[model samples]
Target: MTDASDRLASVRAGLDRACRDAGRAETPLLVAISKTFDADAIRPLIAAGQRHFGENRVQEAQGKWPELLAETPEITLHLVGQLQSNKAADAVALFDVIHSVDRPSLVAALAKAQAAVGKRPVCYLQVNIGDEAQKGGCALADLPALLDQARTAGLNIVGLMCVPPADVEPAPYFALLAEHAKRLGLAGLSMGMSSDYETAALLGSTVVRVGSALFGSRA
Candidate 1:
């Protein structure tokens, strides 16, 4: 197997171990974070059986994914970054899942886009889990209202997504997101990344967006 395939296998093993350790029966969906990598870098993982892949920008995905998708039509493309209201229509038309539904305006834009395009990508409401000022998620205080607004606006919100504060034990934050998911009747928890995905899986993340661990360090 190629180096990329080996890394994919290792990550899968780690995920399986995390599931066993957590006593969780189902493994979280591993959305390979393929933001910067080119098609050549991605095909190795796909050849090894990876179906779900994530990109951070609509424009970037547009420039890179069309040809790739034509090659592999079964791939599930995810938009795992902050989305602008203006790009809502393109995002809905492109991504299979969007892990960044944050504010009311974005929520309304996405709803309108979906209505116009007739394609509703499953979404996750982003939470500022660490309460950081520079983050893109909805404030903890605003999450409930935003979620309600998104639902009322006709968006299919399936879960909560968060990027916990950097350089800290991420367990509590992951747990907090999971708790909110339960309390709010949300079924999916779109947290975790390359650094702490195993911890996230143990803490009940329904989807983990992993990048470097699978694709190797980006240039």
Candidate 2:
């Protein structure tokens, strides 16, 4: 098993190499996906200077955040999975950023929860760039209306996010997302993962949520 320091070094090296190959500036945010891993497994990564992490399930994150925060309050937690409306409140309470706001109802719920929390959790409006019905995201055409609704509801819309169809090339969809974000004047694009992150970097991804490539396959 690779020690956490080795894993951190390897992942950073990969990100740097990817950025150089893509001719893109290295993104300042690389979120190590920590879902399914225990706090003990994550602590060494934190100790090794990893401050940003992504979690998939709300319940899992709910269980992890407080303990992790106790160890490192400065850590930035990102919710990088489909967020059900019922879980919006807990998500708002837990994450520093929510990268899966795919619908207006979720947006509204997040806004309400944010109000109660007294902090506007940075939000990424998930776009179904591949138009995959099985994916959790808004239709690309509905984005403008959703943005308008988010603005009206006082939700802080920081950017857009997407999960490209697995078998297809991800660059075009990533580029499309970059274009959409530019049109909307949003600042973040939370795309890319282990497989196509280099392509995503080339196309313009501000944040890449990497899991297996960093931590190896989960047990």
Candidate 3:
């Protein structure tokens, strides 16, 4: 088994190579997806110079945040999954960036929670580029209204996020997100994952939330 240090080094090398291939800068922020692993596994990665991490479940993040922050105060936590409106307050309290703000209700909840917490939470409006009804994202046609609502609610709408259909090439989906960001005049696009990040970079993703590629397969 690869040790944490070895795994991190290898992942960095791969990221560097991918950036070069995509003709992007070499220092793109890498958010280590630490959803499944416990603190013991995560500590080594933090020690290995990883400062950004992502989680999928609000409940899981709630359990991990304090311990991880206590051990490494500089780590940035991103909530990268479907966020329930009920958990919005907790998510606001714990995460630095909420990358899956998919619905108007959730956006309103996050805005209220941010105000209650007295901290502005950076958010990404998730777009369902593939238009998969089962997925958790705002319909493409509704993005303008959603963005307008978020602005009125005083949430800092920083960028856009999306997950492509698993079976197809992720480039088109990534391109669609970039186009949406351009249309909205947003500065960030949190797209890509373990399998298709290179394509994402080529398509102008400012942030790539990668797992498995960094931490190995989740259990």
Candidate 4:
């Protein structure tokens, strides 16, 4: 079998076991992050039935995915990076799920874009769970109000997303994110990555973004 297929099987098995352990009846969607990887590298996973894919940059995604997407219409593209307001229209047109709705300005921009395009991609509010300065997420203190703003702006805020501070144990942060989502009446938690997806799944991550584990080292 192909390397991508082997890796995909391994990750799927791990996710299944994690869900069983957590007693979660629903399985988390595994988004194979193909940010730096090109279409040639991603085609194998698609051939192996990987429907969900993630990209970090809109320009890079535009550069490649259109042709690939025309070939496989079932593929779901997820924008798993910081989104600029100016790119909201392109983002709305290209992606199926956006995991970084962090601020009111962005919410308004996305709302306007969705209205103009008549396509509303599922959005998740990115929460700076660790309060890190370099991350692109709303402050924990600002999340409640941000949710209100997003709802008021007519964006479909399905859930919350976060990247915990790097190099630290992510369990606490994942748990905190789950609790935060639960408290806000949000159902989806877009947490976890190559290093700690199991923990995130056990804690209730509805969508896990995994990159290197599926595509090997990125360029």
Query: TM-scores across all candidates?
Result: 0.98, 0.94, 0.94, 0.98
lDDT of 4 by residue, 157-212 (tens): 89999999989999999999989899999999999999999999999999999999
Better of 2 and 4 by TM-score: 4
Which pairs clash in the backbone of model 3? Answer: none
Write the residue-wise lDDT of candidate 3 on 38-129 in tens digits.
Answer: 88878878888889999999899888779879878888899999999999989998999888988889978998898898888788999988
Candidate of highest lDDT: 4
Q: What is the C-alpha RMSD of each candidate to the true structure, in Å?
A: 0.8, 1.6, 1.6, 0.8
What are the lDDT scores of the predictions, listed in order? Answer: 0.93, 0.86, 0.85, 0.94
Which tens-of-lDDT digit does each residue in 118-203 have in candidate 1? 99899999999999999899988888899899999988899999999999999999999888889899999998999999999989
Error of 4 at 12 (Å): 0.5
Q: Scored by Cα lDDT, where does model 1 land?
A: 0.93
Please report, as a residue range, the 10-residue window in candidate 1 with the lowest summed lDDT: 1-10
Ranked by lDDT, the better of candidates 1 and 2 is: 1
TM-score attained by model 2 = 0.94
